[model samples]
Target: MKTGVMLSCLGIGVLGLTACGGAASSALDSYKPATVNTPEDAKRWAKNASAPNVYLSSTAVLGITGLNGQGQAEDTTCPKRNQDGNTLWLEGDCTDSEGRKWVGKARRESEAAGSDTGRFVYEGFGYEGTDTCGGKEIAGKWIFEGVVDVTGTEEEIHFDIDVRTDFTGPDEDADCAVSDESMAWDYTGTVVEDGSSKNTWSGSGRVGSSKIGVATVETKDEVIDMSVCDSEAISGTTTLTGGSDTVVITYDGATDCESSSTVQWSLNGEAKGELTGVSCASAGSAPAWALLAWPAVMLLWRRRSRDVRGGRGRRRI
Candidate 1:
């Protein structure tokens, strides 16, 4: 999970390196325009963005809703909660086993079912005594717009999450060379009593000057059983569109017996990387895509600034 969050941040912060290479274009070109034309279109978008890892993603939100240290059992935290009418509000400070402190806030409808439905409003920020979450100072401020919709009955739970976040970047003096990222995620999923479900997710965002996107697009789907999420196999696949090019990746998650996952990536049906270690765990605040894009994003970051006809400096998205 740390890997996924860190790696995803790589895409988020590193994408800012506009001159990173044509790689960003190819890896994220599949996504469409930023605006939604209709409610149905928005619904479809929300559904897809919530896929890939429904249980984990939902749990991730749940952890944030309660500031439970991102659901890491080993972490210690103190939190405050309040209920008013149909809504519940939460705020808290938590310290991970490693002593990193996470502070976050979340508000949501108290009910989990029926037409009224459940939705969450969340904001989270983390910092060490200085910057501790990632070697790149991964712990910054994460703010969310849009509400996460909760559907289904007790026997089954479906989540429709469409989140747009404007991430606060670090100061000019920072250990991590990563840039600020503005991202939007639309995804949906349903988990049954058996802990099995189907999910489709997609996202597009800007990391500085670079643009990035990822989605299942029109691929054959898979039925995932979260309860049995022991890795060791190709868990899923998605097309990553960056800049102007696309890359296909087959993801293999961390087996119950292992600490890391691997990915097989290709472009035009040719292998891009074999046995690349990726963050496949579901225990950190980092998004999974970040882990998958780590190696490639770092390469893009190393490439440098975009070709600006006029001027260049950090501009907040």
Candidate 2:
């Protein structure tokens, strides 16, 4: 399928570089997706360059890129959690069970020996920058804080940039056939649960400046939310910027899980097509977002009330 779309959500800012030699140094092209950045001197020392308690959070992204005619991509992270009691950090293509996957494991250096730190090891599927077997390219870092639980009918999470991939390379790996490079975006999202098996997250994102010029995509409150579990499916819609366009998301499947869920997005109710892989995480494990808004009870209640009620609309998809 088309993996390029997946990179869109993960932030493909690794493009637009000026490489002098033909050596494929970074993890993506190395075929060693998982082990892209072992504890090298420069890279290792950079870890301590941040706060002590901050660990990386794991992310599993599956989506299509608009560039490569909406190609498909899946990415995950290893060592599900960090030493600082944080979840695993992730980068590109975590869902592929078969491919040049990046499996990360942390090791504890002896603290008595003037070192008691964790080091991550990336193991690629095959030797020579190629999975050979599954052809997967992966790279990214993780920094996480503990999960904060929201004390409401819904779950919420709070986090920061605990893990990030390197963004140093040519503007575009255009010749590679797949535009699967690091990209970035600046947007906000919200997830509302309409029912047990139905939920939706909608947000806006923009592209960062690399070799490729800056590109901004505004959803304009364009909500892409859905709930699909076992018996029934729910749908939702949000208007985008410029008011000329809108995306309507629909779910068709079960009511509690996302497996085999069919999500279709439409513009002004016109069927765009079937969206194969759509992954979005609006809140963190913790209710951090909720906690921050707690001080403003009136505001918090209003937002939560809208979420629940808005979910009930259930119009035709």
Candidate 3:
């Protein structure tokens, strides 16, 4: 499962650097994926990030650099709502049953509920970096944000999330094989109800790089449904197209409601053959990428919405 095609989206800027370290790093790598600077920082907090918020590819990647992914869980503070019940303020951390940890902070204006109808501005919600993790030299920042509509009824809801995430580095870990690289993605995405048993999701976005040297990604859209699943299980298919190439992942059995899913990865527009792990989990849990990645902001939307309906989205908030 060589699915590390993430470089195409964000970190491709570091591609040349990953190849010729010093020269490129001194020049292009000069841009160390900005941090929380000021209002001016808010102006460019998410600079160079784009995507439709649907696929598992890298938009801010520099190239394909596999590192020891997703780590242990930690406690977090996810907000329930602002003083006004309509405004769902996202500012916290959460560690799932799995050991994946996530921390996040919303921007000023765009950080809360967008409208009364239902809209959530996503922010970079990811893992807190460490100079060393499990004997690995892991240090980097992965953050994402965008607007999403999480308002819906009992069995159905509309999902339109514009996601932009920035992945900085594995910091050339000692224990884990990693490359010192970075990337970003800003794109659009949509999720619709197909029937009571299923839901359809799709999106399109662009990146400057790809593992296969391509630049576009199209999710002909994947279908997810738990019609036959239990409370702790989920099932679905992921149909994603990168540049001219496309791959699909089909969920045959039960998807652990707790974490990731190991599914069939195929390039023939059908999920078959090779086995791969994907990040498709329930709202409260973390996905594979997100397990260790930052900006678990989307969960903010899901959790907040649940809060609106008097559900558990705003647990511990």
TM-score of each: 0.48, 0.31, 0.43
Off by over 4 Å in 2: 1-58, 61-129, 133-154, 158-180, 192-200, 207-233, 238-264, 268-317
Residue-by-residue lDDT tens digits, candidate 1, 40-119? 22222222232333223322323322232222223324335676777767565755444434466667674632223466
Candidate 2 per-residue lDDT, tens place, 99-126, comes to 2233333222222232212222222210
The Cα RMSD in angstroms, rounded to one decimal, for candidate 3 relative to the true structure is 14.2
**Ranking of candidates on lDDT, top first:** 1, 3, 2
Candidate 2 vs 3: which has more lDDT? 3
Q: Report the number of backbone clashes for model 3.
A: 50
Clashes of 2: 71
> Which candidate number would show the highest lDDT if scored against the true structure?
1
Better of 1 and 2 by TM-score: 1
Each candidate: what lDDT?
0.35, 0.23, 0.31
